[model samples]
Target: MLENWKDKYIVFFDGECGVCNFWVQWVLERDKNDRFMFASLQSDFGQKFLNERGLESKVFNTLYLWKPGQYYYTKSRAVLQIANVLGGVYRLSAVGKLLPAFLSDQVYDLVSRNRMKLANQKCFLPDLEQKKKFIEV
Candidate 1:
């Protein structure tokens, strides 16, 4: 299974969160190379991937990145890594990685915990072309 993802990066996120869904869409839109694939943490494939990585399955509140055979990253680290891959202005976000992990994660957690409330209940739907980029389970 890991070999199958050698050419792709996976982003596992909370499907029901308006903010998370929007971010996924935003990433897809800017991902001209189609280097990323997405899956909701609630999906069976997402759960299996987390379990295989020995990561807590309930940590879906923040973003997750699965870079095939490499180690997985979560929270702010995951977001920054994704941005770095996207290049350009997005790569600038990688500078935040210089901050202490605990402090950065605290901020990430705070925003994630409140994202749903802040974004309301808007459902994120990508366009037909973008839908092909999703690795739905």
Candidate 2:
């Protein structure tokens, strides 16, 4: 099912992180164009991508957005790119680019460090349709 992902954006996140799961659900609800797909960093598919890129495979604190055959964005860059892809009102997030990436990423890291405290993990069961967006491979 993911073979044609060359044209789709794949989001690799921490499946066990409540904060990360919340954001994934947020994006899914607003994804009017169905341009995104997801995988947990603990999943084989997410680990393969990280290993291929020489990224930290044991840490699940970072988020990655990959556009196959193009490029992948991580941390704050991935967040902004995701917002941009959401389009319409979300395009306003482009303003974040005014700040240097290092500065933006610092904030991202800070949040990542405290993400677990931000929200408690809950049993979130996605509807059948939403389940289809996740790539177990």
Candidate 3:
């Protein structure tokens, strides 16, 4: 799906999950420069992206970041890379990179496993002013 993506970062997330959707909204709200494009794991574009990357479609356990021809990151690393792209205070999240990947991923796995339990089903509706930053594709 992303063979033609030339952007610095493409965020792949779980669209149906309230928590995931909320985070996407939060990122868009804070990202004043429109630095990311989103694709749900269930979307055709996302499926094609995973296929092209050789990742299993069934594993929606982590956010996926496709940074053009450079590299890809998952779980905690993905979140951190996204923060770095968003800049400002979000750049602080990059400190997570200091920890061991195994430990960082364990924390990410826990939050992902329990995100549904933490949030209600209502999806956040962004105001018109903030809606332009999000791409549902």
TM-score of each: 0.90, 0.96, 0.85
> Tens digits of per-residue lDDT for model 2 on 88-109?
9999999999999999999999
**Candidate 3's residue-wise lDDT over 34-129, tens digit each?**
677677888887888888888989868679887667788898888888899989888988888999989999999999999989878796777775
The residue pairs found clashing in candidate 3 are 1-48
Q: After superposition, how far is residue 22 of candidate 2 from its true place, in Å?
A: 0.2
TM-score of 3: 0.85
Note the residue pairs that clash in candidate 1: none
Top-scoring candidate (TM-score): 2
Judged by lDDT against the true structure, how good is candidate 2? 0.92
Give the deviation of candidate 2 from the true structure as CA RMSD.
Answer: 1.0
Off by over 4 Å in 3: 1-5, 126-137
Residue 95's lDDT in candidate 3:
86
**What TM-score should be assigned to candidate 1?**
0.90
Higher lDDT: candidate 1 or 2? 2
Lowest summed-lDDT stretch of 10 residues in model 2? 1-10
Per-residue lDDT of candidate 1, residues 59-88 (tens digit): 668689878878888898898899999998
lDDT of 3: 0.79
